[model samples]
Target chain A: MATPRPSGSGKRPTITEVARRAGVSTGTVSRHLNGGHWVSPDSAKAIARAIRETGYVANSTARRLRTGRSGTVAFVIDEPPASFFEDPTFESLVIEVGQALAARDQSMVLLLAGDEDSAKRAENFLLTSGVDGAVTASAQPQHHLFERIQAAGIPLVNVGSPAGLEDRVAFVAADDREGARMMARHLLERGARRLAVIAGPAHTPGGSLRPEAFADAVRDAGRTGGAGGTGAADGPEGADGSVAEGAAARIVTVRHGDYSERSGEDCAAEILAEHPDVEAIFAANDRMARGAIAALRAAGRAVPEDVLVGGFDDSAGAVAEDPPLTTVRQDFRRIAVELVDALGKQIDGGVRANVVVPVQLVVRDSTSPARP
Target chain B: MATPRPSGSGKRPTITEVARRAGVSTGTVSRHLNGGHWVSPDSAKAIARAIRETGYVANSTARRLRTGRSGTVAFVIDEPPASFFEDPTFESLVIEVGQALAARDQSMVLLLAGDEDSAKRAENFLLTSGVDGAVTASAQPQHHLFERIQAAGIPLVNVGSPAGLEDRVAFVAADDREGARMMARHLLERGARRLAVIAGPAHTPGGSLRPEAFADAVRDAGRTGGAGGTGAADGPEGADGSVAEGAAARIVTVRHGDYSERSGEDCAAEILAEHPDVEAIFAANDRMARGAIAALRAAGRAVPEDVLVGGFDDSAGAVAEDPPLTTVRQDFRRIAVELVDALGKQIDGGVRANVVVPVQLVVRDSTSPARP
Candidate 1:
């Protein structure tokens, strides 16, 4: 065997130096740095020792240039710019995802595709910007952004369940359905007979999944005799028969909102006007719940006294509410970790399935003394 | 000039094709694409025509590889992650900055350096990552992150005025001092004889400048006969001799907080406890103003009725308050635009000075009925 010789002096060692010290070609050293695939254990050990001895630090950017990978991922938000700031959940998710990416020596670029113009711009940037992959959040099922991303062949991971492209993309989502069921069961067990729901936009997965799951729980609890659930009553046939049956005994009205405080307040006002004896209100998210609380106070109803309000996404606002909020907690940190991991797998040419994180219900002053 | 020639058929045109048709070298074509500083106008026009004719599209990533420009900027936040979500001003700045960067076809990567470990990580990443530049927000004057960023030779533009580094770094900030003066004049003119200030952290530029300006306004108004202002009275050495002259007439007390709602509430409660007859309270920011409102309400004081409250930053919470906040609006959008522009200039090897955007006072329900 030829004795390994130092290639250069007074400069940082490159892959060529490591290869020369390891008695192998630079390609072998490059492959070793890129996960050591196809290299024998003996060669891998020699290369590792050579790297350690020669102080050869691999430049990730140079490696990316060689492999056509940017080592950067885009965290695309499919909401308006204002919503990016207004929603605490989005903030938490973005921070967690950025931190996670940072830990893996990767960078995350934030892209907002709120409207058609922005969507087109974001799509073009992603297609040609040399980003290795993407993690998207808040995309509606029918939004063409997903189709464009898919067509561009970029590795993708969704923060929430993708509506129609379930098979084509990987996702990580909190179990909104199970969380709604838990909220319903808790409320019902606390003797909340008359309930009202401030649902999110019908086009969103959380909007439909949360309300539908709550209705299912109510039906399973025998509160609404034969109404089946909102899912059944909302069918295209306009089936009012089951809804009429449950209309008299227990008032379970669902009003839709855009998951904003003002929208929640408006929906709550409408619900209160129509159903005067509503004992409990479930807002799809915390901001909406806060608005519901405000509306109740405006109408001379005290939270957890005359009415109990529950929220989802136990955000900072949840604790800051007057009576504090009884809400469901989605582990955003875990979801972010899973999202980065899934995207990493996809970047490595592996397919990943959907990941569902569990949710927990937190009881606070808003729903502690649920009255009959 | 050489006759223009068509290149390959049924394939993407390369730089060679454009160079051939333009009757120039490939180096000239690359230089033109990278911004034709040295190329003649006639040659530039020829290259442009050739590029259009040959449909030659430069690959941004490959160009970046050759030039070592990533076309990415990091928007770093020195505050904790929770603060990023809690403070509306931070959110607005971030959103506006992202939009401005998007317009320039640049990507923004958010980096949170709240803790020591994270700050170290951020410094390391910025030092090694191929990011073109950085725009940092919410960095305290004493934080060593600025030193590291400067030593690493990264072009930086701060969203707010940096203290000691003001001379060395470019920044964009609202006129906090002028805004505070306006608030003081407005309050004094409305007959708020007994005033209190909820000052921001003493170490920060806004913290020091806002309170000092308010004190200067009071001195200029001659409201506190010879006390100079809060800055003089609050300094060490018991300056009580001067304070005593104004203590019996116009009581102005200063309490400091970390620009948080909870801190504002605590400071306001302390102020109220010490001076029950205070007619006006000015919190450093909107969240603190909201907290002051809450504290007043808890003490059975109605805003603008029992006491008047004013805030800074005219954030989302200002309008959302029960009695809308009368506050100073720092035009975050303009500041973001200026920051991005400054960073771009710096990236082009141009030096820029600190930029100060103007502020406006928004009169609303909180202070319209200012009490005597």
Candidate 2:
């Protein structure tokens, strides 16, 4: 690949020097450093010995400089910094992705661009800095950030479907709609005919899909109620809670929260005031579900005895409570591993990939059969 | 200042070109970009205009390459990754430090060097990679990671005192000893004397200092009892619960946990078994306090009614409890701000500094006086 020279005179060693000492071509030496796919075991051994004897660390530095790549990937969390850490999903993603990158001998840098100025600066850094790729979590729906990253010729992967850019950007997602549907069906199967749902904000990927998916599951379960209400309405409005005399499960109401425990508590309180006979509740995330449990307790109703509570994201809170929460657990470890793989493929092979990791429903005592 | 050329061909502009366009020294333009400490407003405006007119963006890249500094800092967490996130303190530090770095136009990369292999790779990366500085959290009591960083001329700041290296390395810590002392006094004044302490691992900075401080305070409060037992012995062993009949107050026992709720539950259950007459507990952190409360509840000892519980770190679980936990609150925001400031100072001025942020005692119902 290059002109070879005899071992240098007491100077810094080069790849060529190692190649000469190893009795192999520079390409073979290079291949060994880049994981020796074709080099024979003997050649690999020779290359290793030559590198050690020569104290050679220049290949990593020179290759990076020649290509202007930093050997680092950015893990972008575009949500508010404080709020992002409050959700265990994001933290788990960070840990998993960090571990995966470490295993591949790559480094992951975290970029929290929650503020607009920070976001703008981050975009500039990605465009001009030496980072080879980026993976984004909690990417907003209608932002130009993704487009800018795409236009800059940087390989980008999103944790969830990026709204309108679903087909364009590679993503790995947990099926939120399917998870919500499972929770709704579980509650119904447990003899819950009057149901209430506490969904996340309507603008987010899960917020937009989870509540409606739950209502649809209820309807599909043979609910014979008034026309289904709008996602925004309360009680018999957006979701018809009033059903025919002998009808099956029906959505009594649907409320929205900001994916926080406090918001869930408030929403649950309002739902209780409106639908006293509501038999079960499904919260979009574990935090909100915990809030709903607090509200129910305040109303003197025992969990799984008077009302069954279900949550999503099987976070720490789900297990911290007595009679642990029944929730959907997104396989974040798999998602994280897949995210790293997808980005690496895009960087090395120019292949764009989308992966959807399945979710699991964890049943706990929160939805245990009510005491007779 | 170097000799500057007049504007010539319509090619990419340089710092010299910008200086010529602005009719100022090249140093003045450089100074303006580095905060314009001595540059006049007129010169700054002229430099800005010249940058716009010349389309100058090479200043950032050239300055970086010329100095061989990446202008990036690493936030190093030396604890096990999964366990690190379970504690809110570490998450808060990450958020605060990230925000602080953003304000100064510096990027903070997270380095989760938990596993041995990952830790070695991280050390190599820090030594060879272009990161300017690093701030570490949850650093084990015994490790050479800091020494190596210092030896390689990399600026390192520990979130807490680095054990025996306190005099040699820069650190920012909350007042763990004073915080523990305050909690001891609070419990003593609350009328209950038979107390227990759930401390963190004895090897950590806080773990070593807190419980011993509490025990020392108890002894100083003029306890009339058998020579206080060792920290390792329960009840009459390490701490004498059998006070000379009618003593002012005495430590019933001291137990150590790994600062986890589950550990707290295990320790508390064991304490209750060995020292059933224990009237109060001071858990080193909120998670442990919650665990202690859980154990107490399981044993039919109502919190505050039968046994008072105090926790350090006013974490989320503190408020989530029905009787919100009364605990110590570390000023993490202040610590984080100070951490960034210290590292930046070290990087820019080569001045190592150790700073300590204060802590506060938040009185919640967990430590409330027994209701009549």
Candidate 3:
């Protein structure tokens, strides 16, 4: 089917023609087309019909010149193309954020700064593109895009905790530390003594906080003599040694992945080869957990029988896995909503608000005690 | 870590401060910041360092008023949020398109018109946002966004063949019909007699053309009497009753899906229950094909031993499946590049150019004869 074009003289129709055809004042037609909020249903229908009849197209350039607000916001990603697609959290964030912005009559422009050059270009674009604000998800620590957005003076909100820029920008993030604590404790409850973790990249907030919290939980379990009691020890020492906890003896072995499935598989293999008696594996995200499962199968171990596996981010992959993954669910949708809300507030001249959404642990077959 | 703020007195930095720190003329600094195409490396570095030091932020509102172009484009999606994330094709398209636009120094605004209200809001946003152009991927037939975009007269391009609006806009799509023909012939060559197809939604161009081409291949094979010949008489009537092919006699039975994995699984199950003798199943895309494999496994039918399964769009799922999927490879990156190139042309006052990229069949373990 072809687009029904304006007939006869091959000239485009005008607003005047549309107004005349609709039998309404030009102001009514204009307002109806602009938003139609105040326009009555009869007039809106008439205006819409007239628009179809006359083939009149609104000139956005003139409207933008008059309004000074473009109704556009940029959703920036600091990762490469492959990573963007492979990560389900990014997908969910983008979808929910786009929908939230749409409900507010704003469009989300996606910007990818996968490399230094792209970041430079994105910085320039954000500075000059006339976007009302910007929202970012899963930004790596020290990513240049954060500084660029700040330098552009755009109202910005990072979906996750902006590692180093938390004080400067508005941000909404899931409680990664709390979620990890829950997962680690659950794994210990399932008769796991020697625990291993496939941690995310150290440069990311989720990566750093999740594993740190899990390590603390393991140390706490060790202090409690493998029971669920609160230990007298504070926690495990921070990976950097800058922050100290009571315990010095290590109970959890941690391996890092870049939040990719392949990385999870490789790390899991390395951990298994090095710590053959490890009873539980907690991957920082669902994708890595899936990889860990595959590696476990290859190594002739049955999940929840020989070893228990737990993961963070109850993504679609968690549900789809053979023995569905036991995972911590980060409410990405809520985070998206909060990001938009924070960005919108800042755009409206409100002070930046930092938000941390709650998370929950979902038990599944991968960690079920019934599995022999 | 906090963003390093401008120290002392709390006065915001100005362009003059940046110029003074860089030891360059204001005009030179401005030119370097705008595009830096002709600026020397030393001057550019000095200007960047000076801007960083002074904490100088560009006034985007003032700059937008001076320049008519907003340097923004909308990447529109007509599907729901769940489908948007579930389909790897959409993920690839959005990422690639965003990167392509970024390469041209343009930011991509994502607009999701999942429902009627959202679509209307998206139309209004597109009509008033001052975006230079728009690009959409996988637009279904009768999607209202297409007409709204055309009526707005903004330079627009659809990433796939948009049914019913073919002549009105620019588009770049992978060759779906030829790809389907290749899959069908491959299946027949593998000693398949009875074949069933899990088709995509009929309202989509891919949904319509893929099955038609496969049927044509089946009829052609029948004419050669290769154990499953139903011979050429006249082909089944096309959806529009237009393009005539070979024969109406049944060689391939089809079930439809909305291009989702669950739908593929459900449709495959139904086909197996109804046609127990079916030797091969061709799913329209890899996600559905993965579902088909899962269903086949549940039914105790081993892949390539009991039945062969082929799919389209060799997505990540194709490689990750237990028995990796044999599917058609559509170069999504190329399509994205072409989309940006097309939109760029239209923005540059060039007429619409329709492009069709070639597709290839990727053979994997799913179609290998090892199961029996």
lDDT of each: 0.72, 0.71, 0.72
- lDDT (10s digit) by residue, model 2, range A145-225: 675466445689999766666789899888878988888767765667788999887656557677878888888866444
True contacts kept of 1: 0.09
Choose 2 or 3, whichever is better by TM-score.
3
- For model 3, what is the alpha-carbon lDDT of residue A191? 54
lDDT of 3 by residue, B62-153 (tens): 23333435567888888777777777888778878877877777667676667755666666666544466888766654546776676555
Lowest lDDT block of 10, candidate 2 chain A: A232-241
Clashing pairs in 2: A229-A238, A229-A239, A230-A238, B229-B238, B230-B238
Model 2 scores what on Cα lDDT?
A: 0.71
Residue lDDT tens for model 1, B1-372: 111122454344577877998899999977665434466656766776776465342233233434545556788888777787777787788789988987776666677777654554565455434456789877765556676565445679988777666788788889989999898777655546577899887756557888888877876766555333344423211111122223322436999888889988998899999998787898889888888999989998878776778999988765676899889999988998998888888877657767999999998888766322
Candidate 1's DockQ is 0.10
The TM-score each candidate achieves on chain A is 0.76, 0.76, 0.79
List TM-score per model, in order.
0.69, 0.71, 0.75
Taking the tens digit of each residue's C-alpha lDDT, what string does model 1 give over A46-74? 77567545533223323443554545678
Give the clashing residue pairs of candidate 1, or none. none
Candidate 3, residue A60: CA error in Å? 7.9
lDDT of 1 at B364: 88
